[model samples]
Structure formats: C-alpha cells, structure tokens
Target: MITLSRRHLIGMGAGALAASAVVGALPASAGVKGYVQSTIARMSLPEKVGQLMVQEVYGVDPTVDDSRNLSKYGTAKGVDVVRDLHLGGVIYFAWTNTYDNGPDGVAAASNALQEASLETRPKGRPDRPVGTKVAVPLLIATDQEQGIVTRFGPPATQFPGSMALGAGRSTKDARTAAAITGKELRAVGINVDFAPDADVNVNPDNPVIGVRSFSSRPDLVADMVAAQVVGYQIDGKVCASAKHFPGHGDTATDSHYGLPEITHTPEEWKALDAPPFEAAIRAGVDMIMTAHLLVPALDPSGDPASVSRPILTGVLRDQLGFDGVIVTDALDMAGVRQKYGDAEVAVRAMEAGVDLLLMSPAPLAARDAVLEAVRTGRLTEAQLDEKVARVLTMKYRRGIVERPLCEPALVDRIVGIPQHLEAADEVTDRTVTLVSNDGTLPVDVTDRRVLVCGWGATTTTAVADALARLGATTTRQTSNAPTAAQITAAVTAARSSDLVVVLTNNVATSASQVNLVKALTGSGTPVVTVAVRNPYDVAYYEANAELCTYSYSPVIAGAVARVITGRVNPQGRLPVDVPKPGGGVYLSFGDGLSY
Candidate 1:
C-alpha cells in the first residue's frame, strides 16, 4: 500500500490551483484523506477547502512538473495538496492512455484512478468497518454530453448531438442513446455526467449551442430532457445533470466569451424556456448546473444565474421543486472570473443554494472564504451541513461511501471493449439527417467521370472509400469554389461522361465559403449540392438537386451514402431553426418529422 504524507497532500492542493493559472503546469494529486473517510468526517479547514476546488485534468503526468497534465495519474510526481487538502474530486479534461475500461475504456480508466487513490490512503483507513474502519473515496466526473462533445475513444462511437436526436423526434431514441452514453461513462469510473443540455435552441444563429441543444419548442425539449434523465439514471450507471438552467439556448452570445444576458419577460420565461427544467425536476434528475448568463427577467438585480438566489433557489428549487445538488459552470471561465473574485463568488453561490462550487480559479482562497463565512455566521454552519449533506447523499446513493476498489486486473477487459465502439458507429449511422433534396441525388457514375468539389471535400473520403469498395471511378477536387479554369476542366471531363456530383462540406464560419457554394452552382452542367454541414447553406446553390447530411462522421457519412443510393429513405428532420439566405430562416424551433 502507498503511504500519503501530510506534506504530499498540501503540495498537491496548492499545485493544482497554481497549475490552472498557467498552462503546462501540473495539478496536485487530488484528494488527501482516503475517499471513504473524506466522504464523511468533519474535515480539517484545508481539507474542506480542497474539496471545493476542481481543476481541469488534461492528461497523465510523469514527473509533477511544468509540462505535466495533472488529470492523468501514474505519469508525473504527484502534486502534494491532493492528499493534504482533502479535495473532493477532479474533472477530466482529456483522458490518458490508461483510461480504457469497457465501453470504449470509460470504466477502465475510472477503475485505475480509484485504485491508485485507494493505494495511497494512510495505512489506518480500511475498506470497511473491521471494527470501525474509516475510508473516503474520490468522486470522478466527465462531460459525456454525447454527440460532438466527447473525449473518450479514437474510434469511440458518437451520437448526434441532443438537438439532432430531437430532430429525429423520438424520446425513445434519446433515452436509448443516453443509456448507452451512461454505460460508457460508468465503465470508465465516471459517476457524474454534465449532460443533457436542456436549453431549447431558440436562437438559430446562436454560435455555440446550435445543434447541441434539443429543440426550440419547450414541450419537445421537456420530453427529450426527461428521456435523457431516465437513460443515465437507470441501471445505476451514473448521475445526470440537466443544465445551463434557466436556459442557454435563447441567448445569441457564448457564455465562454463573457456573461450573456437573456432579455425575456417573466411571462416569456415561464412559457418557453422553463418547461424542460420543470420536466427534469419531475423526472428526478440528480443535479443541475447553472448558466453564467445574466437573465434580467429571472433576476432583475443583474447577477448571473450561478450566484442569483431568485434563479437558483427561488425558481429552480421553490418553483420547480428540485432538491438535488446545484453545481455551477466552471468558475475559472471568463463569465465568472472576469467579473468577481473566486472567494466572493463561492460564498455567494452557497448563499444562492449552489451545493457544489466548481472550477474556482483560486481554490484555496475560495474554499477559505466559504469556510470563514460559515464560521463568522455570515453563512450558518447549518447551511454548510445542508450543502455537504446533499453532496454526501449523491455519493452514498452512487455507492462511493465504502470506497470499493475496482480490481486492477479487470481494467484490461473493461477499457475500449469492441461492443461499445460498434454502438457508437450505429448511433452515428442512425442520426444522419436528410433535410432536403432535389431530384438529382443518388448519382450513378459507373463509367462517367464524377467531379466532386468544395471545402472538406476530403471528408467525403469516407464516401470515396465506399465508392472505391464498390469499384467506382471518381475524381475529387479541393477548392472553395471552382474557378473558370476548374469549371471548364470539370465540364470538359463531363462533356462525354455520365453525371456531375458536387460534394459540398462548407464551413459556416466564413462568408467566403457561402460565396464559394454560389460560384459552384452554375458551372455549365447539372450539379447536386451534397451538404455535410449546416444544411442552411444549401439554399445558396442553384443545383439541379440538393441533399443535406449534417455531419462528416464515418457512420453519418455511411448513412448519407445509403440515403443517396436509395437504400434508406430520408428519415431525419431539422430540429433547430436553420437560417435561410436573403434574410429568412429555413427551420424554426420545434420543426420535426416523426417517423
């Protein structure tokens, strides 16, 4: 068994915070007292403080140093504070190679992390009450929001984002995918998942949560939110959080940049954005993460939702009746750090009924301030007890109390098992949407030379691979727009050939890419705009026919190919509002085709 020194623990805690200020710095080993004991017991001031600060883990460290990734274990020298400060948990930013448990190695890494922590506990703490033995286990968490926001497998299967699933208009699919996501998460030792973004995609041009959100319609969002909650919480896989409450979808700005304000009236709030949360509460979701955006209608005093009582306690708890943990968005993000000091914000969050104060820039200072507030009666000890109790309740319910040691030998079997990867492939396959089509799809180029063009035209490499598998002669070109020379070349090649297939995977960020699509439209021949991005761009082209397949993922690519070949009928519908060119939006919130 590894021995943890008092000195080692202190150093880890301090190092973890210091590392966050500057990149390439190492994080202190997380949590001091063993997970079992740390779970209970009146913690020392430093230990209590440590539990509140969680830094992002990049990868494993070899020697605790400037170049280390604090999140990965068995790599670098351990940061001392993790053992000394008695921190609560660590959020993995990226996974180490060691993190392969079954279901794409989600559980294996979790097993290894917990096993390592258990070995380092002081000799006195036993796994169980062999005549009053004490133990404390660490809580491990991940952002397994499914779809595009994953950090698990190189070949890990990905589901369409929540919005895409919503577009499919089936709660059954949402629930099943969530359950699959949970299985993968649990197999990796991740007990907490920050997921099921309940935000309705109200703003189509919203830069960030476009497809990540469910639907613009609150009712559909509510059902999908309920499905996600059920899927994760079932079969004891993991705890679920329906997040960015009040809602992140209505705002046009990204909270990652700065505090965003949602300017809805109270009536608009209850009618549109609040239904999903209400549905989540009814479903008994485990946690709720607050958004950093400022909503004047929710809290006219102008405080962000994370520190606002009206939103956190009054609306979320009292109105919606949610009594679980309320974790704030990362405090280190610009939304909070740019405005207030960590300690001040931490204390206010507690006052506002936030049970978990996460990702603080100054963990020590923030932890100390919250403790002091309680000690000085600014925040009562009773309040501290309540907050800690909620955390403990989650831990106990999740079976973190006994500090079970995952068998190290089982790690190999659990990490990246083949079945889960297949699941990812299938989920991705099923989610490809065929938004719109003109008559000219399913191109047959048996003997004809096919000319493919546009940005990410290479993404069609998968489609090309399939065509190669089927023994088709194809020529692919990489150009934003075909020049007059390029067009003449294409027409010359096509003058005697069968058909023209214009594969367009344009990036929406640049206006130039949109112009390129228009340029490619009238190139003296029949053309099809095969859109593999935001399908809204398809309107720019005057192709004889057009097809929309919203992603370039292998499974989605395969699905798109099948749809084009007439093997599969078009099934997916547009879930969020897709912008129409010339100042009109094509799709709106709540637009879906049930199958």
Candidate 2:
C-alpha cells in the first residue's frame, strides 16, 4: 500500500494534469467519440470554426527569422501553422518533403510530424487528455494517379494511367490496380488518397485529363471509378477520395492555368459528367474532392465547382445523397486562388458545404476568418460542429483516432509485393487494342529485317526489344532524326526480307513521327504501323496495317509485342470511334478495347 502525504498527492495530481494536456486533454484510451464529445464541450463558438481550414503545408517559409512557419534556425514553422492556428489539417504540395518514390519515406514523415503535433499545448490548459488532443493527427493526402501523374516514383510501382485501365474495360482489372495502389499508399503512411479521377476525358484537346481520366464513355468511367474506390478503401483501409466532382472531361483548358468552362446544360451534365461522380458517391467513397472548372449550366456565376453551393451541397449532398467529407482541390491553384483570395475562398467554401479547405495559401488567415465568421454569427457554431463531427467520424472509421503506432518494419514487408506486380502485368495485357491491321502482322522474323520508328520507339524501347526477341533484326528511329536517308536505308534492307513496323507515339507539341509513317507507307515496303497513343493516327497516316496501343507502359508494350509477333490475338475493339482524317471529333475517350 503506497500511502502519500497531502503535499505528495497534490504533486502527483499536478503530474496527471500535465500528462492530460500532453495527450489531448483526455484519457489515453478514451477513443475518438469520447474525445470529440469532451472537446466539443470546451470549444468556444470561435474555436470550433477554426477546425474547417485545411491549408497548404508549404505556405510559410521556414528560412525567415520571424517567419510564422518557424524562426530562422531549423525550428519547424510548418508544424506551427497547424498548432498555432488550430488548423484542421494540411494538404501536401511540391514543397513538403520529397517522397522516397514509394510509401515508406512518406509514411515515416507523416507519422513523425503528426505525432510531434500532439505535444505543445498552451501550458495552463490541462494537458490535452490522451485521446482529446486539440491537434487531431494530420490527414496525409496526395495525388497518386499512378502513371504520368504519380507524385512518388521508383519505390512506388508505376502502372499505366487511368485511360489505359479504361482501355482494359474490365472492372476486375481496374479493382486489382486500385488494390495495389491502396497497399502502396498504406505502406507509406498516407491515409488520404486523392485519386480515381472520375473526370471523363471526352475532349481530345483536354491537355490535363489526357492520361488521368479512365474513359470517355460515362458508364465505363463510372464503373472504373467505383472499382478504384474499392481498391483504395476496401483493399487497403485507406480513405479514398474520388475527385474533380461533376467532372472536367470535355473542357479544352487546364484548370491549373485558368478556369475551364463546361458549356453543356444541366441535362447534358447528367448525360456526361455526372455519371462517374454519382457512381463514386453511391459506392460510399470517403471523401469527394471538388474540381476547379466552371459549369455554366450548373451554376451561371462562373464560379468553379469548389465554390458552387449548388454543385457541392445542393447536388452532391442534397440530391445525390452524399454525406461524406467534401474537400476542395488545392486552393492555391490559379483556377481558384487567382480569382478569390484565400480567406474569402475559405469562407465561401464552408458556406457552399465544403468540409475541408485544402491547401490554402493562407491557412492561419483562413482559420481566423472562419473564427470571425462564427463570432459575427455569419456562420453558426452548430454548423462548425456538424462539419467537425463529419471529420471526426471519418477519423474514427479510419482507426486513426485510436493513434496506433504502426511499425516501420511492417511497412517494408508489404510494399511492392510480387502479387501486385503480377496483377499489373496481367491488366496491361488486356488493355492493348488493335484498331486496323492488314495481314502484315505476325512476321516470321527468322529472315526478316525490321525498321521501327516514332516517339514510341524513343520512349518505350520495349517494342524494339520485343521484336529482337522474336528473331527479327530490327532498326529503330526516333522523331524525324533518323530521317528520310536513314529510313530509306532501313527500308531497302527490310524490303529484301520481311516486315516494317513503324511505331508512332504522338505528343501535343510534335508528332513529327507522322512524317516517318508516311515515308514507311510510301516506300513500297511491307509495313505494319502501330499508334500507341490516339487511334486517329492510324487514319492520319495510311499504312498496310495498324495497331493502337492506347497507352505506353512497359506491360502494354510487352502485350503489343506479343500481338504483332502472332503470339496472341488482338481482342480489343475501339471503345471510342477512330475518326476519319480531319475528323469532326478530334479525340476519343472510350475508344479502347472491350475484350
């Protein structure tokens, strides 16, 4: 029996008080629900409003001596933005620590920063009870769209883009890709994955959605989006966010530079942009990130989707019945920030029913503004409570509210597992589409001299290597450099032997390889042309035969090689119409293989 004097008991009491403040002003195992209740009881009307802000991690400069982010001398000002302003969380951008191409580095950084933030309570306040820490763990989110849009490389498995998956046209294939993506994300400690872009890439001129969107057809895109939600959430337990709500598919402009407008009316909206988002919401997605584009038919104010109440609350919440967390695209992007200042954008987003104000340039300013709105009665405390409750609910569901210490060693074991790579290779095979081929393929290369040209030749060397493996002595040319003279020589050599496969991968600025395709078709050689990007290239440059590899991935490259060498039959049909030269529609979205 340990008995203590009154003075000693008082000292022990003081230590407990200190311990409570350190944890979150609650008991260690109190759980998020109990913690939220305790926290809500103590918050002032103004304090509750501050939790809605989700600001940019890079807003404050760490080098400035008196900088709000930190004082000069390596003190972390980044952590202060969340702690001092009592911000809800942060959205990582190019400035936060660079990821180690995989999830391990990201996970370590995310866990460390979030844990550090748990300390640092104003001294007098009862040490934050264990579970009731005012600074809820930071929500680690990123744009990991796999292929070209991947934020982390190397350690992270890079697969073909969403469009390539759409080209595959199998829900099972899409889900498998999503599962691998989810596992990789969890291993890295990123809880929030902003992905499965629901945007339909209907416009060929769509510079942004080129490889990001899953498909052009609404139904196909919707199905794929649903599959991604399952992969990231069900398979990995990461909170998956389906993004660019209401879609940005048909727009010609990129939102990063300016606000892109969608001219279609509300009815047309239902027909095109709404399906994938609707499916995603119905699939029980955890978070829905708003887009920056303007839909005049949906709201005539020229307001981007992030600020449109009709789009966010009226449609997504009221009509569509989505009760999940609503997050904004990065608020610092020119599409939104260039027009609306950070504070105003923050307020408007909250009013418009956005639950998370993502990556705002002025996080503290936004927090102050929301607090002021509550003080002035412009935004009620009840509204803030509702939003906080939703956020807290999500945290609870993710088991993050429990504050589990996941071992780093466990993370190392699961990343880049063999099964994931095997699945990715299989999915890649199903997506290879053959648009038009005359009998020139399946070259018995035992005696054939082959010439391969185009950006595909330069970018994906797998095509050339595949040909070599098939016993064909192949010559490769990139752009127009291995010009008429070089191409003519290769043609002369191959003319006496067998096949000439001219592979063209088009780029926005220059598909100069088109000229090479023309030369190959004109040379009176046995030519089989392959277009690895847009299918229309097949028509633009006539050849004896043609194949469309809708994407350029190592796996897709391997599948293309097998098809051309007659090892496998090309089973893909155009999901979108491959138009005539000078076609009315410049690009096709659903134009991929079905089987």
Top model number, lDDT: 2
lDDT of each: 0.62, 0.68
Which RMSD values do the candidates have, in order? 8.1, 7.1
For candidate 1, report its TM-score.
0.81
Q: lDDT tens digits, residues 385-486, model 1?
A: 567667766665565543332333443454445775565555554555554445555555454455555556546566655554544566666666556666
Superposed Cα deviation of residue 482, candidate 1 (Å)? 9.0
TM-score per candidate, chains pooled: 0.81, 0.82
Steric collisions counted per model = 51, 21
Candidate 1 runs further than 4 Å off: 1-39, 61-81, 95-109, 116-134, 402-430, 444-453, 479-508, 524-526, 530-533, 550-552, 587-595
Backbone clash total, candidate 2: 21
Model 2: residues with Cα > 4 Å off, grouped in runs: 1-35, 39-87, 90-97, 101-103, 120-135, 403-406, 444-452, 456-458, 465-476, 480-511, 523-530, 584-595
